[model samples]
Every structure is written in structure tokens, then in C-alpha cells.
Target: MTFDHYGIGHGFDRPGFGEAYFQAQGISAIHVMGRGDDWYQYADMDAAMATVRAATEGAVRVVTYGSSMGGYGALRFADAAGATDALALSPQYSLDPKVAAHERRWSQDFRRIRWRPDSNGPISCSARAVVVYDPIGPDRWHGERIAQDIACHLIRLPYTAHPVTTYLSDAGLLGPLIAGLLDGDFDPQAFRREARRNRSANGIYLGELAASQPRRRVATALSLARRALDVSPGNWHAQVSLARLLSQEGRHDEALSILAVLVQQSDRSLTYVVDLGNAFLHAGLTTEARAIADEVLSRAGDVAHLHAWAAHICWLNGDVADARRLIRRAVTLDAGNRVYLRAIIDYHFGAPYIAGVRGVRVTSWLRLARWMMKAPLRPEPAEAVRRPFPFRRRQDDSASDSAG
Candidate 1:
């Protein structure tokens, strides 16, 4: 069986998820879709388990699979439905308020949800759990927490933050890893090899890595982005990173060139589209950026991140009224999504919610301190993952994302 993860809002373009991938491998799959409250509040999990059993009826065996929010559900369902094993990618330990008080990323979402069990019980499921996550990423706290009390084997890959599947899939590792686990032949070394094989070409990884470098090493950061483009010339976000860095260094022409080629490309990745719009605006290509933003907002998809991007573009175009409308729309679509909330905070608090303050160098000790305070954040390269403007001037009330 398979379950889908929690995106801030649905990616309407995505037709299928795990079930589709598994089906391609000749494995029959049952899918569990989480909508609205995302199972924590709306799903009658027990009834769904009964349905799975009734549907599978006398099957020789079963295993559960999911990533992120879906991963949490997979383990929760595996324990309830008596699945023999579970494959969870970046699973959270629990959403029970008391247990997850220290978890900051999705706090507001937890508060409004109809959290069922007060106490987060241990993973007492008979099934052996296989979890893959980045130890330094957002999933670390929960991943580590689950490993502490369960019959589980941990596969820690730090190259990708939060949803390792995004990075894993980029390396063509997810399908094989899941297949191997299902066949009871998972080879950790093989998995590691697969992850490393195309590391250089993983533009998202490279872009993230470059953004994490010290501010004083802007040249080094530019080189990392250059390396990223060398291996994957079509990485739009990497191009945007490169352009942003060049712009910071006062090389406007070169920056505009990188973004010009990027905006002309045919890549359809959401972040690519979003970052392209950012690059266009940064290059003083307002009409072009506004066109893309308008097109994104006009689409039927309700993805919060995309809406957030569109909102940013509107703000950039000085359409404050339209920006307000778009940001409000984003909040309505996914109030739990912090990016949207951050936009609201930026508007209300007059702070650089997206770009953050100038030169806020998060020291190593600060990272450790945050780790002790709550979950350890994938600090470096993370902020740069989305924020791309380290040298940006605080003009009027806006800042841009270069990394995380």
C-alpha cells in the first residue's frame, strides 16, 4: 500500500505518487489519499485499516509505504493494520501537541488539527520499520525520536534536507530502494552508491550547498553554483542562484545573462518557475516576471508555494493590493504553511520574513543551541535553499531568498 505526503497545498499537476511508481515496477499498489485536515483530523484511520484488510483479503503479505506526513501515516497504519513491514521516508515521530511542542516548523497546523491520541505511544507495531532521512535536516528530530523506541533500521543521508525523497528521486534511488526493501534485499551500501553516483549533477543539492557558505565566501558560493550548472546546465534554480550572486557582486550584466537563459528554458519544475520569476524581477525584467506570476495565479492549481511565489511577484511589481489578495489566498489555501504565514508576518511586522535581516550569520554554536532548543535545523544551505539574496538592499519592505 502507498500514501502521499503533505505539501502545503496540492500540486494539481501531480496525477499519481507512490502507487504510480510501484505500478511501473509491476507491483500492485493500494493508495491512501490525505486531504483537507491531512488524516490527523479528518481521516477515520481505523475504518480505513478495516477497508484495506477487506480489500486485500487473504493476501499472502503486505507492507506499508509513505514519505513525510504520509510516512507518519504509514507507520501508524502499519501498527493498526498489522502490516508486516513499513518503509517510511522522513517520517515524523508524532503530531500530538505535548510530544511535539518543541517542533517549530508546523506548530500552527498541529494546534488546529483534531489530534486524536493525547499520548504518543511507542512504535509497538509488529512490523520492522525502515526509515530514510537526513540527520541534519528538518526530519532529524522525529526520525531520531522514532529510532529510539522502535524495531527499526535507520538510513541517514544528509545530502537532502527534510523530504529526502526529493533528493533521492533526483538520484534515481527511490524506486530501487523501495523495491529492494519490499524484496527483503535492501543493501545500504548499494543505496549509498546510488545516492553518490550523481551527486555532482544534483543541482538542488549543489544550489543548497553553495547557499550555506559563509557570507565572506561569496566567491566560493558563486563557484559552487557554477559547479552546479556545469553538471546540470538546465537547473533553473541553480541558474537563479548564480544570477543572484553575480548581481550581489555588482555584475548586473552577467547576472541578467544567467537569468535570461533560464527564463527562456522549458523546465517545468515549480521552484524553477518561481525562481525564474525571481530572477526576472531581479534583472529588472518586470513585465516578464509579472507575466509568469499572473499565469501561475491564473492556473487552477492551489499549491501554496506557487501562490506564495505569485504573491511575491505581485509585491515586486508594486501591486500591493494584488499582493495582499494573493497572499491572503495563499493563507486561505494552507494556513498551516509557514511560508504563507511568514509572508503575513513580514507584511504585518515590517521584517524581512523571506530574506531575513542583513548578514545574520548563524554561527555553529547557534545551530547547536537551536538543536538543544528544539529540532536541529539543516542550517547551512537551507536558508539559501529558497532565499537567494545575501547582498540585497532592504528596499521598501522586501527581501529575497537565496538559500533556505
Candidate 2:
């Protein structure tokens, strides 16, 4: 359900964004329009709460979603009426003091109003609350701080220009939002998988100490990475780095096991697929590598670099015709890419600009290099790098030596 205050005055009278989302998800929707001058008045709270209560009386669950000013109203209403869950996007806790001052100076009736959680009364709802916002926006951050103080689940979407509801009109955002709403549906396992994937793409940092001497501080770095994974098992960087370290230590089986789970969970990620395929190839699991390469190519056919990678796999299997076709398609799609262009010249025409560049080896190397370049950069894993260690400190380290 949703409430609209900002929508009414602007002649943008339509069902609220939440209402539309609910409808799209094959759920019933109720949109309550705000009436009267200055909808921010607290007097409207009771009426709104009453309306929500009446509408969702016998329902199994009731979720409240709101954005902008309506988001503020929704939070107040959810606290009062007792909703199953509340999702507020880009809400404002209160107008800026300067803005309030400006209004007060301009109008005699404009009194400074602030969001008083105490005045709204104690919240009785045990709803799994989620507040989505861009941290960079001051007005949005005000609401985010309130959500944080209340121990609400905060989903910060950095670099977003505005509220998620406005930015994510492309339907993909609904997947996560819907998944969040389902009872007992929180997937710690999925989070762990994502965390691992992210770490693999972006190098994780444990801390200043560990980062200062990465190889020399293996034990501490591993400990820190483990701790980060424990805190949020779904952190990709923690998982990836853990796996990478394991791989570096000749624990290829363990590394592959960690990456396998991530690959299974993240089928759509081209980078994940590529990484998994590479891991399999390194393990000498030819069948698995080929299967993964094929799956990635099928899903990412339009991606020129992915196609080129698949062509390399075909070439490895001695399917010259298929390899040639894929490389041709890749060259057509990305004409300016020197990597693809060079591959075509070396492989198809047997022409090498560089010295000692045999057609067969050059084609193979360029294909593999192109695939590596296509893997998406994962930044979330970098957070794990900040920790440097994932385990409890030994007594000796605290008392005796600063050096590991």
C-alpha cells in the first residue's frame, strides 16, 4: 500500500509508485491520497492510520512503501498503525533548519516542525523494515540516520541520483525488493555468495597493517578476511580473497569449492561465469570448463568479448569453423578493440604485426586476454580488504610485539 501527498498538488494524480509495483507483482494495492493544505500537518496522521487499519484489517500481511515526503508520512503511519513491514525511499526526517527558518521568515503561520519519534509514540510493529536511500543526499541521509537509530535495515545505494523508486523503473530492482518482503526469505547463503563474487573481482583489503605487508602478513590477512566473511557471509570480496589466497597456497580444490557456490548463485554475472570457468580450467576439469564457457557465451551472446572467449574455447576443442565464426562476430561488434582486431588478424589471416607471433599461439593468447578484460570489476570486495584480518587476536600480539 502507499500514500501520496506530493503527487496530489502537482496534478500527478495517479496510483502511487508502490501501488503500481504491487499491481505488477500481482498483488492488490490501496493508494490513499492526501487532502487539505500542507499535508505535513500531524493532524492528518490519525486519519491516515485509520484508513490503513481499515484497509488491511484481515490481511495476512501489510507492507507500507513510500518515497520523498510521502516516505516521512509512511514511516509515521507505519509506527502508529502497526504495519507488517515498511519500505521508505529517500525519506526526510525533517526539513533542513535553514529551510525551515526561511519558511518561518516568509510566513507567519510557518512554525518550525521536526520529526519527533517520541511524540509519535512507541512503535509496536516487528515488521522487517527497509529504508533505501542515497547517502550523498543530505535530505535523504537525515531519514537514513533515523532509520539507523531505530535499527531499521538500511540499503544504501551509492552514486544513485535520487530515490530508488525513481531510479529503478526498469523492473530489475523489484526482484530484490520482492525477495526482501517474503517471510523467512532472507538468504544468508545468497549474501555470502555475492560477497565472495565481489571479492574475487575487486581485491579486498584487510587494514592498513595487513595491507602494508600483504605477503609477509598472510596469517593476519587471512584472519581478517575470515572475520569479514563471518560478519556478512555474502560479502563477495571476502569470499573471493579467501578463495584466491587458498588458490595461491595450492589449495585449488578448496578455492574451486568456494567459487562453485558463487557460480551457481550468480548465473547471470558474466564475470562470475568467466572466473568459474577459469577456475575449472586451472583444476584440469575440461568438461566443467567447457560447459561453463558455453553457458556464459549463450547468456552473453551480444557481449563481443564474451563471444571471443567462447571462440577460444572452441578453438581449444579443435572446432575451427565455430571458433572462426565467433571471432568474426566479435570483431564486427567491437571494431575499435585492438584485442579483438589483433585476434582476427592473427587467427583468421595468419598476419602478426609483432615479432615471433605465430598465428596459432597469438590467437589463443589474445582470446584468453580478451576474456580476462571482459570480466566486470567488483568493488564491494574491496571493503573486505580494509579489515586485513578475520580472526581473534592472539595474546602475544597485544602484549609483546607490534609486528606480525
Task: Give the candidate number with the greatest TM-score.
Answer: 1
Native-vs-model 2 lDDT?
Answer: 0.56
The alpha-carbon root-mean-square deviation between model 2 and the true structure, to one decimal in Å, is 21.7
Q: What is every candidate's alpha-carbon RMSD to the true fold?
A: 12.1, 21.7
lDDT of 1: 0.68
Stretches off by above 4 angstroms in model 1 are: 7-16, 36-40, 57-61, 95-98, 102-112, 118-122, 193-202, 234-269, 284-291, 300-317, 323-404
Give me the candidate number with maximum lDDT: 1
Residue-wise C-alpha lDDT for candidate 2, range 1-404, written one tens digit per residue = 67664434433455554665567778776665654213355656677678778877888767777776666556656755557777677765544334333221112112223434443333333566666666644655455456645667666654333444543333235457645564546454453344334432222323212223358777876666566566547655456656666665567898798887876677546666687776776676766777887888777565667777777666665666666677767755554455665655455543323335565556655755575586556645744533221122446644212212
Give the per-residue lDDT of model 1 (tens digit) for 274-369.
555666777787778888787666763565556667777776677766675666666666655656655654543333234654322234234434
The CA root-mean-square deviation of candidate 1, after full C-alpha superposition on the true structure, stands at 12.1
**Candidate 1 worst ten-residue window by lDDT:** 395-404
Alpha-carbon local distance difference test for all models: 0.68, 0.56
